[model samples]
Target: MGPSRIIAVRHGESEANLAYRRAGERPLVYGRGDDEVTLTALGREQAAALGRLLAALPAGEEPEQVWCSPYRRALDTWEGARAAWGAGPLPLTVDDRLRDQEQGAFARLNPAAVRERFPGEPARREAEGAYAFRPPGGESLADVVVRLRAFVRHLERRADGRRVLIVAHDSVVLGLRHVIAGAPDAELAAVLEFAPVLNASVSVWRTGEGAFELVRFNDVGHLTS
Candidate 1:
């Protein structure tokens, strides 16, 4: 009766996740020779667990369609969940809009490296909720929100009465949260300050009249059990 419910799920933990470096900051090497840098064993477990959680949802609340980022890590997560929902044959659209924000020179760097490279301004911005601070050749939190706004608007208009599952990255998840919460740009940055979106966490949204409400945020109901 309204815009379809959006269940935004983050991709499983990645190799960079365990490596103490943020993959988004690293160069684009996936689909070339980056399989080893995909998901970690724990990430695989987390994805399977998420699948079970999704499978357990009531049929009425289950997703009727699925969308995923083109990244191999995201696709790997979706594949891990295939069995839990019996979500066979349903086309999973790949939307680059859902890709993670580029981390610039910080992609494969640790905190120390980030600090060394960026110095006072970078650290200060990271600490003080600087959503608009764009790094060299990368995106800022504000940039991510802008992209997510378009995606949400499209979904709000194109979908109705069904649940849509979005398998995406942390930047997308964080942006979606800010969009649904109607947070001011300043506040949105505060929310992400050092709080990385965990693997396979879910954020739920309901939209109407060009607006959205965050029904749930960072929901790890599957992991609690």
Candidate 2:
């Protein structure tokens, strides 16, 4: 039987998020590689708190199987929260496809720096926009949807009665919305114009008679508590 409930949780805030906050969208002189980045002190707390919340979820929502990004931050969030939640021996699988959108040439840089260093890129981005124009050497949002399409199918095939948790980065989490629920680009962009998926936030979906439906998006009430 395939899994019935699907949950996607963004990894807790990282040094990367802190760096972006400190720099305010400007390039940081230093930043960790995706695999090297770790959760901040608060991030660790958030992850643990998330675990406790999960432990207290209604039986229907508790995770039965887990998959996480191979990146350090995502891996740590899943392990820390699960251990803290007191859930015993749930199976976890690390999937590289769950990794964050690869940063490539801008791996550790921000938007302004990309413009200053590669003046042409800004114009290219303005012309092609977020959905199409990939950062140099990086994957586009469209590219992410392609792979996520395959991954979602893989999930449906194995989900029978399982409540699965996906611990991953923001892009991976958002990409799943498009693949799993067919969120329209305009709808997603409009929502993103006002809000971002916070660290350790949870989004949920479940199979229906016809297709998967979004149960919630970016639910972070657990973190506030």
Runs in model 1 lying further than 4 Å from the true structure: 21-37, 120-128, 184-187, 207-212
The residue-by-residue lDDT of candidate 1 on 1-225, one tens digit each, is: 435578888888887676664444443333322223478897788888888887888867777778888788888888887765566676578888888887675565556667666677566566745677776777888888988888877766656666788998888888877776667766776667635787889888765666666678788778768
Candidate 1 residue 135 C-alpha distance from true site, Å: 1.5
- The Cα RMSD of model 2 versus the native structure comes to 2.2
Our model 1 lands, by Cα RMSD against the true structure, at: 4.2
- What local distance difference test score does each model get? 0.74, 0.81
lDDT of 2 by residue, 74-152 (tens): 9999888987898889888888889888767877777767777788887887897666768889998777777877787
Q: Highest lDDT: give the candidate number.
A: 2
